[model samples]
Target: MLVRMGKNWEISEEISKLQGKIRNLLKETGWSVKDFADKYFWEELDSDGAYGDEDDKSRHAEKVKKHLSSSSSTAKRLELLKKYVEFIETSRLYRKDVMPLRRETASGMQDAGFKAAMRKLSSELNELLLKKS
Candidate 1:
């Protein structure tokens, strides 16, 4: 007897609430979609093997060994740390790409507050990530 429950409205409501929270957080934190996209760039790169070294199994094994031996934490934590560092670097690159627009907007509106807010947001995010590392 396969008795499947009907669609769960409660789950949908929870997801909607989460989406709203994420939107608000992004707005308050000044985190842009481009930054999030860059954080995920490595996933795309891994799938596409854009890096020529992906084909070199020996090099990959050595790199994996280095990561595994670098810390006393569990292997999962070490891998997470590596990914977090990569994500931060990628986000910095994405932020740089939008620097011109940021400058232009600040200058046009004479909004030092907006610029300062952005600086604070970037510093806070970096600090949080570094502490995690």
Candidate 2:
């Protein structure tokens, strides 16, 4: 029924809304994080001693990636998160008692640019489907 279809669309819309927030958060904070990493890496290298060309953003970005990546293992972070979640879920009715908080899935949140592409594709497909019918 049309009502069920609308209800189903609600989840996708929620996903889209959450995806938009994630994309914005990543866009804003990724730069801030990288900037912090870039400074830290630069300082570490400079203290240990050397100067790369001042104009090269690529060089700085690379150093940030290298150092930021080496700073923590994803496996360890995930392991900690798993234990934390288990503790929260089992030891207390944490999420059940809390007010609803919107969040994206850890692995599946997509950037809005991709969502725009998907919308474009969906529009084209809808047009084609209508013609075929």
Candidate 3:
């Protein structure tokens, strides 16, 4: 499980909790941090024009934060979170492929704090999926 930095929840604890759970699931299933970010996240992220050829294939932690910090439609955010859970579910059956890979754009990404947040979001989405199951 990803260790969240704060005790008190911020921006809806329920969402954070669920996000964390799904994030942990991704890790347990061998998905990297990049897997959480969507293409929109890439457009907002400034990677110093690095890996122009790779594009969405990679991203840094700072870029991830920049993507998360900005205002965006909830639908987009929910879509990414939903993908995370679905990817894990499918991977268990040997379908490890995810369209538009979210691998690390660079080596040595910093700070696990945002990852914790993404995880929380992912978990929250997974919870929603479960409710319907």
Candidate 4:
């Protein structure tokens, strides 16, 4: 009877391990889904052109919601996650893949200051161009 109990305990331990793996896989699947949607919405879609109006934006949101609802199962999520990984591996972004802003500059200012200065200079140049026109 003790030997049989030991075997049962071992089985339960193995089942627990498998359940943990499934849980982690589900979490990873969720992250991948969000990442894919983020890239699709921000990088792939032309937001300013196609989703300019409120109606267009709502329509696109509905489409996204519908698609996500349809792919709610774990198996579907895994399949989509695999495709997302494949797509990311194949896509060629023009810019080098590097962290945009790592930390503050030596002067204790963020890169936003540099960006703001450049924007100010651009606006001044645009004003001059308008005057010349």
Candidate 5:
């Protein structure tokens, strides 16, 4: 799967281990299920231009609400998901795949200060989790 992203066709044991770690992190952080689908909606919008069109955004937002009603409504959910994925992807503590996504999302934020602020939130959340253990 990583190979599809780039030219490094070689799959190392270390990379496999890292993949496992990322999967575990996703599960532990409650990011693995469809229940968290709204999270992906905003991230996709930020990273892939998936929701750039108003029609697409509205449809995706409806899907988000259908999947995660607790965070219902397209606009509010997009805002929340953007905030959450931004924090998670930008923080140094998250895995490498997160960085590319973070950089993409930062494009929307535009301001370095806002991006940094989101990163700080991410770092704080990571710290809090570490301390809990």
Candidate 6:
């Protein structure tokens, strides 16, 4: 069974709750912070957004690794988690799609595409916010 984190009520609260759940998950699963970041962060993050260059992204990932490795307080970890959630969400929301502007395009294709993308992102977010029990 998986231990789910969010109440699906409010984004802020849900994210906060998720961070704590993630901390426990890390402890229980014997996964390093780097493992978690590699599994959940790099793939979804937009390098063209807040993380402009590959180097910048690498540095940020290192920062997360160090932060988690330290004896940081629980409050600090939760705060960092909220920021990470925000970074991914903001990048995805503002990312410029490469869709070609064609006058002959189908009427609802763009909308359908957007819906599909959102569904995929939501599913990924669920994996991050859930812990295997």
In model 3, how many backbone clashes occur?
Answer: 13
1-133: candidate 4 lDDT, tens digit per residue: 4554564455444444443443354354443444445555554465456655556545655554454444233544444445444444333321113212122224545487786776677668655544542
Model number with the top TM-score: 3
Clashes of each: 0, 0, 13, 0, 0, 0
Q: Which stretches of candidate 1 lie over 4 Å from their true place?
A: 1-7, 41-131
Scored by lDDT, model 5 comes in at: 0.48
Model 5, span 1-133: residue lDDT tens = 3434332322333333433443455565656434334455545454666456656656765664453334233444444544544544443335444332232245574588888888788778756655542
Residue 117 Cα positional deviation in candidate 1, in Å, after optimal superposition? 32
Give lDDT for model 2: 0.44
Q: Look at candidate 1 and tell me the lDDT of residue 96.
A: 50
Compose the digit string of candidate 2's lDDT tens values, residues 53-86.
5545457666434533342334443343343233
Candidates' lDDT values, in order? 0.46, 0.44, 0.48, 0.46, 0.48, 0.52
lDDT of 6 by residue, 1-133 (tens): 9754553324445444666655665554455566556534555565336555768666766877665445443555656776654543333221222221222324465687786776677667545443220
Q: Point out the worst 10-residue segment of candidate 4 by lDDT.
A: 94-103
TM-score of each: 0.30, 0.22, 0.34, 0.26, 0.27, 0.32
Give one digit per residue, the lDDT tens place, for model 1 in 31-83.
Answer: 65344333344354444766535345445544434443343334454444445
Q: What is the lDDT of residue 130 in candidate 4?
A: 41
TM-score of 1: 0.30
Ten residues in sequence with the least summed lDDT for candidate 1: 97-106
**Backbone clashes (count) for model 1:** 0
